[model samples]
Target: MKKLNYLLIAIFTLGLATSCDSSDPAIIDEDDNQSGTTITKAGLITANETWTADNIYVLSGKVVVNEGVTLTIEPGTIIKGAEGQGSLASALVIDQGGKIMAEGTADKPIIFTSVLDNITVGQKKGSNLTIANVGLWGGVIVLGKAPISVSGDLETKQIEGIPATDSFGQYGGSIANDNSGVLKYISIRHGGITIGSDNEINGLTLGGVGSGTTIDHIEVVANQDDAIEWFGGTVNVTNVVTYAQGDDAIDADEAWSGTLDNALVIMGADSDSALELDGPAGSAATEAGYTIKNVTLKGAGASSVSKYADLRDGLIANLQNILAYDFGPTSVVKVNGADSATELAAGRITFLKWEIVLPAGVTSVSSLITGANAGDDTKFTNNATAITAASAATVGANTAVFSWTYAKSVSAF
Candidate 1:
């Protein structure tokens, strides 16, 4: 009886010790869950909040920053969007009066990827995803109250790739200096989810973003749609890089009067044009156009079908210091529509110092742009005013600025 009582007492003492110890295995397991909080963010962010780098955020659905709210994100933060399709797609949207200050450095760039990616906290790359993985989730969309062209001269217009029922999708106003926010050293990858037929999200959709917004050192990879698109705004971008996109690398439409400086586009397997320039639609065609300089477009060279650039929809652009190389033999810079040709004749749509290295069997620039269709063809070669046979671009995207990018890791440059 004494031995039995001793054994029962020992058991009670051990249980008491285990319960009193704060660092017990069970307690530690419980503390692990509470140590670093994983925030699941969805719906509208009406209050101001700062997302830190230590915490992981999962965007389950459409996450919108409501008006007057500011969402600040720390550098090296990884934001992952859940795998969704149709109306259930996930995206991060900044409403008209909302702001997002996501400022990152070359050493620590902010990454936006998909939840399907196996990247954890503090990791730059994922094991499950690569540059070939496209359309994994939706992309970033920023709407602002800036000038945009509309057929009916409406003060505001609904942005495409979104349902019209979502009133927050509408952008554009008279404020040319409307401020959205800042985005620097940000890399968006594996995005551009398709919502409907011929409607898909872009890597970075700037809808009526104004000059007050600061966007620089941006990189987008493996997007299913255009890497970056500006729908009528004065927001200028610098040091932009796009790789392995499924559509146009850079698409400017709705009379985007912005300037894009120092851009590099490396074509993907299913890519279309390196640059697709479309002016204002219908009666709003008289608005200011866009200007692009110091661009290097590397094509797929006989293995892929993609255009160097396509200028149409009455676009008025001034393209200078462009270097296009390794494109398919038939790929050419074609100008469609009579309005675009008229702009070319008027010197409004002009190309200066454009050096193109065509593929085999494609000789002269004239052979590419035959001008066999309607409208004036001589405007492309008037005294070598436009489409001048010049040397390669002396200045393109500074490769050093993209050292921290995924493209650099894969030697895309």
Candidate 2:
């Protein structure tokens, strides 16, 4: 028995040695040059290289994206969070200048899920996967050198919480044309919740990104925090979905100037607001220069809530052409603030051609749109040609000017 144990130990050591080949660039080189590198274990994959899943690839630490490189993840690749045990772990971090091209097809989307043992046949279970579930397993953070509001001198402001002296978090140095690659047909499930409240990360956090960033056709499922949080970026996105997130489905703050179109958020029953926008009230200026259109938010909870908008101390929001349904009895669209007169005069919460379908005991649409110039219609639009009771098209189509051929049933949570 002693000899057998010794043989097993020898085999294990040999496997470890093989996995730790210093010559392989993916495992050893932090610069992310993958000319002659081979992936053996959980480590960073340089940009412009293809990564295929051998087993379940667990990211034990931060995954950095070097400049001028593109990280291409093949279809059906499953990236898992580390066991975490007792410490925080970040699954993937795309630094400023690096690009991630995780392009998956509809048939086989890239899945990032938890590492649980129990298996259920049909029920969806809560993921043990989170930033704080173990430790600081932060979600993907993308930084760029685009213009960002600085609290101090240009030399003193940290980029994405990392010091300016650090190369690992710096990207798009001096050069203006830095392009973060495309992310399409990717599903990030059961993420969010890093170190603690302040450090807790979201499914996808864009910090100081630019218009060159490509974001489309992404889904975030059951995240502990917001599904997507944007902090001062100019990236435009389309065809995004957020499902059962613990906090706001989409939280935008810090002077974000992005565009969101064709968004579908199916909130959890107990979840908070579907959309939240705060501006300088939390950090910088009190104005948002973004555009939101063709959005459908359906759930049993509140439709939308803004902390700064109500306080009249945050950024101004431009919400157009939205469809919200099945908000619970207590749900409402509230805008309260000290400077309510000035904020409303600026069309901060303007509603144009919006429709709302409520249950029996919920508040009326007249009460919701009390002091605003939504459109020609003083009352909330109901059951237009787009949203009929008999057979309805998807929410995505209703928000767009063109009609969609594909039909989907809209149900309350």
What do the candidate models score in CA lDDT, each in turn? 0.79, 0.55
TM-score of 2: 0.71
Local accuracy of candidate 1 as per-residue lDDT tens digits, 275-350: 9988886466533468898888888767767988888777988887777777888787778777777777677887
TM-score of each: 0.87, 0.71
lDDT of 2 by residue, 79-193 (tens): 6554452124545767666788888766556666554512122112233443223222345667776544444413113334343444455432222234677887676766676
Model 1 weakest lDDT span, ten residues long: 23-32
**Regions of model 1 farther than 4 Å from truth:** 1-36, 286-288, 370-393
